[model samples]
Target chain A: MNVVLLDPSEVRADGGASLDGRRAEHVAKVLGKAPGDALAVGVRGGKLGSAQVVSSTKQALELEACVFEREPAPKRPITLVLALPRPPVFRRLLQHVTALGIERIVLLHTRRVEKSYWMSPSLEPAAIDTQLQLGLEQAVDTVAPDIERARGFKAFAEDRLPELAAGARVLVAHPGPFGPCPVDVPGPVVLLVGPEGGFIPYEIERLTEAGAQGVSLGPRILRVETATLALLGRLGG
Target chain B: MNVVLLDPSEVRADGGASLDGRRAEHVAKVLGKAPGDALAVGVRGGKLGSAQVVSSTKQALELEACVFEREPAPKRPITLVLALPRPPVFRRLLQHVTALGIERIVLLHTRRVEKSYWMSPSLEPAAIDTQLQLGLEQAVDTVAPDIERARGFKAFAEDRLPELAAGARVLVAHPGPFGPCPVDVPGPVVLLVGPEGGFIPYEIERLTEAGAQGVSLGPRILRVETATLALLGRLGG
Candidate 1:
């Protein structure tokens, strides 16, 4: 864990907390923290700061004090609209984007998205929370992104995407003879990345009608997971 | 497979080839290619072309005609120097960078890198080739990267790095009070990324002494794989 992140409820009224499991193991072994050493700490959806280790053990770490001095980690003004990938890939995608600081995520349905992907256990709330926590831990951030599922491509294109793209720079990452993905975008951006096979022509038209301009990542076709990170890095950087 | 890649020996004198394996499965089911269908094909480390499927079954595909007119996929002038990641992560990293068009890769040993990582079966030549081929298939590319193992950090930094960094924009990705990574670079670049925990101060100093200019990715700490992709997209874009 880059930084110890705790839920608000985990901390006592006096700003002390005790953590066990992976975080504790990280503190005890990976970080090799000793008693009285200050450990970087943050609360989920809250402030960032440091906490003093009151006690440290292989499986547990107790914090005697915490001081919230700085604001939470910054969130990128980017919302990722991804066609549900394979279950294994989806897990990694969640962690990757979450680490990259995407503020919102939309699990979208496109013509090429497999129907069975929606049934994967990776989408369960608790399972997703685990992945998001892993990302936050990796990035040393505490902000959890809001995630939504858009099950119907037509409904999402006609009813929701237009509203989402009204003021945002909506770019659909499609392979074609088109412009490059923009960098250092000024405002909010809603990026739609299709499934592995890519968006069919009809689906691309629907997305375009929703205000997303088709953009080529490059000549080489990229996996959705890698493509998402590349886009976020360029856009957010 | 976005593009089917075959070894030179696999193609017969008449330019016909039969494949029965994962590639065949992809061609049969995922692509749903029928008899006389033109499939995008490439010779590994050779030409990019198309092959006409003479017959297709769930487990095998036979090609009766082949045309290789186009050049191989382009390779970026970026050489990556990475502290070998965890075994599972390494498999993905190799494929990731290969797909991103890195021309050369050096898997280096750093102070923080675990000694046991060198013993991973994933490093076997056959295993490495499989990952590279998968990456080539993913990106529709035929070029493969040359990867080297640098067992000693000091020797690499002193004996080898000076020559590698010579006349190249060498940037070592390290967290520090350093400048942002450059974009739209004029020439070749050699990028060195550290282990998960990061390179120690002494290692960073040695790298700097060897002519690497330190650059920060951003505020957030990123996994080596994600950081590498982000850098490639920015530098190669």
Candidate 2:
């Protein structure tokens, strides 16, 4: 863990807090901190700063006080629209995107997306938080990404997408004869990535009608996770 | 598997080849290919095309004929110099980077890296091949990436790096007050990445002395896997 991240409620007004569980274990073992050692700390949905270790043990740690005074990493102006993948893939993607500093995520089921994926326990709120928190700690960021589930492709594309992507350049990544994916796009980008086999032809047509340009990532096909990071990285000016 | 990759020796002069093991199992089960069904096929370090199944059983298949006429994905020009990570992370990275079409990987040890990481089974040839082949299958590429072992930081930087990095722009991804990493660097690139805790000051200094420029990947710290993808993605013009 790069930073010790805690919910705002976890810290008292006096800037003191008690931490246990994974974070505590990380402090006790990975970091091997002694009492009075200053630690990098951050408040969820808030700023980043430092805190002093008041007491320490194998399973828990107490902070004498906390002071979150620095701003976290700048949030990227991107909204990721991803087809729900298998549970394991979904979990890893969640953690990676969160670490990359995305502010919003829209999870919708494409035609090829297995319906079983939505039933995955990884979609649970607590499980989702665990992955996102891991990301926040990894990137030393505080803004938890807002995740919205827009049931299926048609509903999301025909009803919700038009308005949601109004001022943003929406790009759907698919293989075909199309322009190369844009790099260093200015302003906001709504990147839509499909399932493993890619969005069906009709689905791509619908997305095009919804004002998203189909962009090819070349002949080399990448896994959705790799493509997501690559697109975001290339687009992040 | 995107492409059924076979060694040149696997195919005869008459274009007949019998596949067993995973590829055969995939054809019999995952792909459900029937006799006379054509499947995309490629030869390692060679061309990509299709093959027709002449016979299929639960565990093996016979190809009536194989033809390789198409080229695989264009090989990328980046060479990655990574500080050895814990085994599991290294395995995932090996797969991910290979899928990204990297042609060369130079694994080395840095001060922050644990000595035991070198003893990992993941470093074994067969184990490494498993990961690389996974990437080749994922990207539908036929070429296996070349792996080089640069055992120690000092020796590699002082001895090997100078000549290997001579004409290429060598950029070390390190966090600091350095300028932003250059994107789409012209020609060849020898990109060096440090281990999790990052290279100590002295290592960074020696790297700089070896004609390597330190480039910052911005404030957000990314795991070596994510950062590798991001850097290579942004640099792959």
Q: Which candidate is the best by DockQ?
A: 2
lDDT of 2 by residue, B46-134 (tens): 99999999988877889967999989877777889999999988998898889988878999889999999999889999999999998
lDDT (10s digit) by residue, model 1, range B100-131? 87899999999999999999999999999999
Least well predicted 10-residue stretch by lDDT in candidate 1 chain A: A228-237
What's the TM-score of every candidate structure?
0.96, 0.97
Off by over 4 Å in 1: none
Per model, the share of native interface contacts recovered reads: 0.64, 0.70
Instruction: List iRMS (one decimal) for every candidate.
Output: 1.5, 1.5
DockQ of candidate 1 (2 decimals):
0.67
Candidate number of the best TM-score: 2
Per-residue lDDT tens digits for candidate 1, residues A1-237, read: 788998988989897998999889889988899988999998988888999999999888999788877886679888889998999999988888888888999999887888998988899999999999999988988998999999999999999898788789999998899887777787999999999989999999988877889887779999987787777767854
Q: What DockQ does model 2 achieve? A: 0.71
Candidate 1 CAPRI assessment class = medium
Superposition error at B177 for model 1 (Å): 1.4
